[model samples]
Target: MTSTDAASPLDFPPTPAVILAGGLARRIGGGDKPMREIGGQTILNRVIARLAPQCCGLILNANGNPARFAAFGLPVVADSVADFPGPLAGILAALDWAAEQRSGIQWIVSTPGDCPFLPRDLVARLHNAQGEQDAELAVAVSDERAHPVIGLWNVRLRDELRQALISEGVRKVDRWTARYRLAAVSWPTAPFDPFFNINTTDDLAEAERLVALDATAA
Candidate 1:
């Protein structure tokens, strides 16, 4: 993993963030994965807590009745695409929303809602790497594996992303990102992977254990 002590410029503005929760969660019994509880708190709650401080604003990209997420008081945006394609759809929905709702914002950060321990420095590190490399986009990497969904996206690319998804039927994020000057920012996975996400019942149970371990360490 690449290491860096460099911080984002003090004048740099916080980017808007989108919590992707549009998945059907078939592996974990077909419900909202972020709504699953971990250490008495929902994963979505944990995600918001971790990201809210780092981002300028938070938006939830989900399908179904928005009322289900009304408790969070965030503007829940459903995918504009007819069928739930994937995270790419969610990212596009967020980009559109950001463009319409947030004036003058040029970028947005994205993360899977299921990840409970997203790094606090996620946005800063991504922006830092993107700026340093003079890349058009940046993604998070850990232990040499890139987490495509966890990255920073330029809002201007929304049109291209929309064309790729709707017209070309491109689904894989890496496939689309490969077309750009992308920078992969790495994070250490020593104690535990900060991007650890819940996908199955087993993974959820493991998340509980990790939460306990976190409390014990604290």
Candidate 2:
């Protein structure tokens, strides 16, 4: 994570963020994984709290019934594609929603709903990295592993993305991102990876432990 004191100048505007909550969560049983609790709070709540400040505004990309997420008061959107393809479908859904719902928001950042420990400077650093590298897109990296789903996207490419998804059947995120100029921003993993996501019961238990550690550190 970029230190607050050493934060670089960001030339881009504050990008809106979308929490991709439209996962089956088969590992933890079929239910909203973000609705699961960590440290007495819902994972979605922790995700929202962490990201709301960094974004211009926030929306949730979730399929199925939107009523379950009504308590959060965020505009929940479903996938634009017909079937559940992958995170690419969620990203495309958010980009289209941002274009229609949010005026003047040309760019957006995507984060997984189960990742409650996102870095504070996530959006700023993404934009900064994209600008520095003169790239068209950027994704977060930690401990040399790329979190492709968590990325900064240009809303203007929504139509192209739709074409890639529906017509070309492009489902893989890295395959799509590879077509564009991409920037990778690395963060330290000494403490914990900011992109740590819960995929199973064991992962959720680990997240609880991490949350306790964070509270104790604070």
Candidate 3:
């Protein structure tokens, strides 16, 4: 459904969320893009602030030493697949983690770590759209572009995803999602794109500007 659709009062169970941060970040230099600063706060900090209240729990999907994220106090999970297959691998890791640690949770939401201005209603909107459309998966859309990486995923699909990544070599999120009854939920990009991500030094500067604009508006 489009962002112009009427709002619903429906409430849903809080789904667990995973922040995908395992990218190589070659364009912005080889380090965590979420660790960069915007308005004196790290992008990762901002992402956590927006997502924590909307989720039952949060986990960071990052490779290498988990201790680097110790201060965040999140359970850092590495991809189970070899050679950093891509964001799908991170999603797989999250699904496995949720199944093992949160047996009662049947679904989880995933977002890129670089997106600091994620919509507060992301989880609720995705779940609502998925239920209304009878979709097996739901992804966020902004400015008419589908963001496959930022979406709600069914936990039971972990095994299938593992097989796709390991056996079939499926690395693109949209490719696997294409196999499901997918729903695209749209959000407004007017005031600012809630899905805006930092991919380069210029985008970091723009994020700082957005932060200033947000503070002024507040």
Give the TM-scores of the predictions, in the order they appear.
0.94, 0.94, 0.94
Worst 10 residues of 3 by lDDT: 1-10
lDDT of 1 by residue, 103-206 (tens): 89888999999999887778888887888899999999999999999989999999999999999999999999999999998888857888899999999999
Superposition error at 56 for model 2 (Å)? 1.2
**At residue 19, what lDDT does model 3 achieve?**
99
- Give a tens-digit lDDT track for model 3, residues 157-178: 9999988999998989999999
Provide the lDDT at 26 for model 2.
Answer: 94
Q: What overall lDDT goes with each candidate model? A: 0.89, 0.88, 0.89
Clashes of each: 0, 0, 0
Per-residue lDDT for 158 in model 3? Answer: 91
Q: In order, what is each prediction's RMSD in angstroms?
A: 2.4, 2.1, 2.6
Please list all clashing residue pairs in model 1, or write none if there are none: none
Cα deviation at 173, candidate 3, in Å, is: 0.5
How many angstroms is residue 85 displaced in model 2 relative to the true structure, after the best TM-score fit? Answer: 0.8
Clashes of 3: 0
